[model samples]
Target: MNPVLGQVPVYNAYGSVPALPLGWVENYTPTGQPYWFNTITNQSSWVYPMMTSKKIPGTNWLFVLTHDGYEFYYDRDSKTSVWEQPEELKEAMQELKKLEEEEKLKKEEEEKQKALEEEEEAKKALEEEEENKKRVLEEEKEQARQEVKRIKLDQAVDNAEDVEATEMTEEDIMWQLQQMAEEEVGMDREEEEEVQEEAQKEEEIKQVEKKPELSEQECIEKFYQLLKENNISPFAVYSVELPKLMLDPRFSLVPHNKQKNLFNKYCHELGEQIKKEKSQNTKKPENEFKELLESKVTTKMYWDDFRRKFKNDPRFKALSVTREKEALFKEHIRNNLNKKNPIEDYKNLLRHVKEIQKGIRWRDAKKLLEKYDVYHAIEDKDKREDLFRDYLDEL
Candidate 1:
């Protein structure tokens, strides 16, 4: 009935066929043409098989060829086929792309959150470090205060011990007399009278042992001595130094108001002494600086000009501080060059200018004076013109 059936294997029925490739079976249509059947996909086609369909790796798609020799992709779960790729595979890829974007966004958010947390932690750690330093400084100050208190307490205890020892000696003598009187209760009255005379002489000796009170001047001198012994600076402020001074045993000897007055008086005298000493110490160098300025600098020269001219000199280098050297230069200018009279110095400068003859107009004289450094020394144009007029009047 069919010529192709003679070329293919003959079977009594489709179930009676021998084993074949996976998901594939050789069969014939009712018209007796050769075709293929997929036992797994349950689909039939009429084309000579080259190979069975295979699943694409990691996907629900299969690489398929039709029995008519057309190639495409197939999705068995959706039972859909396409010439290039199945719609289900495209949808799955879209879902995967969305998931990847979401994952990337989630990762970035995690990194940002982690950075914020680290920044906050760093700020907290810095605050803690500063707090610890402050705590340590406070502890050190407290320890110093306590040490000063301990020294004053030790001195007070020594003075108290001396007074207590004298009182204890007197009490022992009285106790011995009492014991003797009780034991000699039947003895004569002359013995008791002799003991009373001895006790009266002891009372006179105790009165002589008492120390005299110090005068106000003596108390003030003692406070100064204490300050010197402690090496306190005369420039130290009274309020700041009061706490340390109060720890001294001599501090309480004077009345509070008197102590304050005495402290002010002592500091004033001591500060003057220190100032005089410093002035004496620095006088030589100051004189040297003044001499350098007189020799090398002039009123015509500015500070920068002087620096450029004498920067290499030993005297200039010796005055190391910029402000101090500038101060000395100004003082030298005031004393020597300007003679504490800048207007007169300018007038003299104008008189010296050969071009500035008497009765010359201020405008013409200013042009001539401008050629000299002294003209530029007076910064105000109006002042220079006024000084020029004054010099003309003198002429």
Candidate 2:
């Protein structure tokens, strides 16, 4: 019979075999028989044939046959060869799964820890904010308590004075009554009439003294004096201070309806006075600060350098608030350093004055230029007038 088609072709030794194909390799069996193996398909056979296989759809797997005649699958992508499935691949897959689970657990634990830390930080910030609020509230409470105590003390003093006055009046009345009784016991008819008339006159005097009235203007002045004596600020709340003010006997002299209006008016006047005094006080320091800047600072100098240079100087230290000092420094730079020609600016402003004439006095010219900012650029009135004179001569 003819040889079966595709029968095995055997080789005796490795060197006896022809050069293997690109994807085929030569191997030896236990009997020293040469065999052909396909690396891509994971197939082995004694016969060498040009064989091809289709890849699994959407996969790198191919159906392969082992040398032992067992069916298996081969992955060209991962290069995994197995009969059924190798125990090592399964064990490797299990190990890979375990590693993924560990990584996931580790990430989750880290996320939980991060979330807990954020929560703790937020809780700490909230607690600190609450503590600050509590501290401020306690401070306000203490201040209010002190104010109430001071008011009570003032009221107590007023009450004591009134009580003493009342006792003195009662003692005086009793003494007068006893004198009248003694005079009546020893008097003739004419003397009795005199004593009776005198007693009537004394009663009228006591009634007048008990109900003495003050003029409205005097009452207002008295109340104002009381406010001054107590050192009450113009910013003092009317409702809050009313109880303290009422402790003064003069507070009752004014009619209730007019009292509020009077209090508002007095506060307004006091406010204006305080404002004027504060402005005056502020000017001294501002002037000193300006002089210090002019003497020690240069146009090239910045605020930090100037402050460092003269921080210990009395003129620099005169301005207490840092912002105020910074503001003045900025203003000085804007007015003096930034100006290319301040005198020329002043001249231009004077040129715009329609009321200025050739022979106008410096005072009249100053009044006209007072409305212009450039006119105030020069701090000294005399120097400004001198500059105006120079400008006039130029004209």
TM-score of candidate 1 against the unseen true structure: 0.28
lDDT tens digits by residue: candidate 1, 1-395: 22565432222322434344566788887888888888766778775445346566568776665555655665666666556554557765566557768989999677556645654566587679968976796687567656755775677568556764455577766875685565446343544675588669868977875535889778777889987877766666566576567745587677754665677788788889999999877757656777798788867666778888888988888777898997777656555544456766677787677877777887777677655445555668888877777777877
Error of 2 at 297 (Å): 2.9
Report the poorest 10 consecutive residues by lDDT, candidate 2.
8-17
| Model 2 Cα shift for residue 136 (angstroms) | 60
Mark the regions of model 2 whose C-alpha exceeds 4 Å error after superposition. Answer: 1-191, 203-219, 222-253, 260-279, 282-286, 298-308, 317-395
Clashing pairs in 2: none
RMSD in Å for all candidates: 38.8, 40.5
Q: Ten consecutive residues with minimal summed lDDT in candidate 1?
A: 7-16
Highest-TM-score candidate: 1
Angstrom error of the Cα, residue 68, model 2: value is 90
Candidate 2 — what's its lDDT?
0.68
> Relative to the unseen true structure, what is the C-alpha lDDT of residue 169 in candidate 1, on a scale of 0 to 100?
73
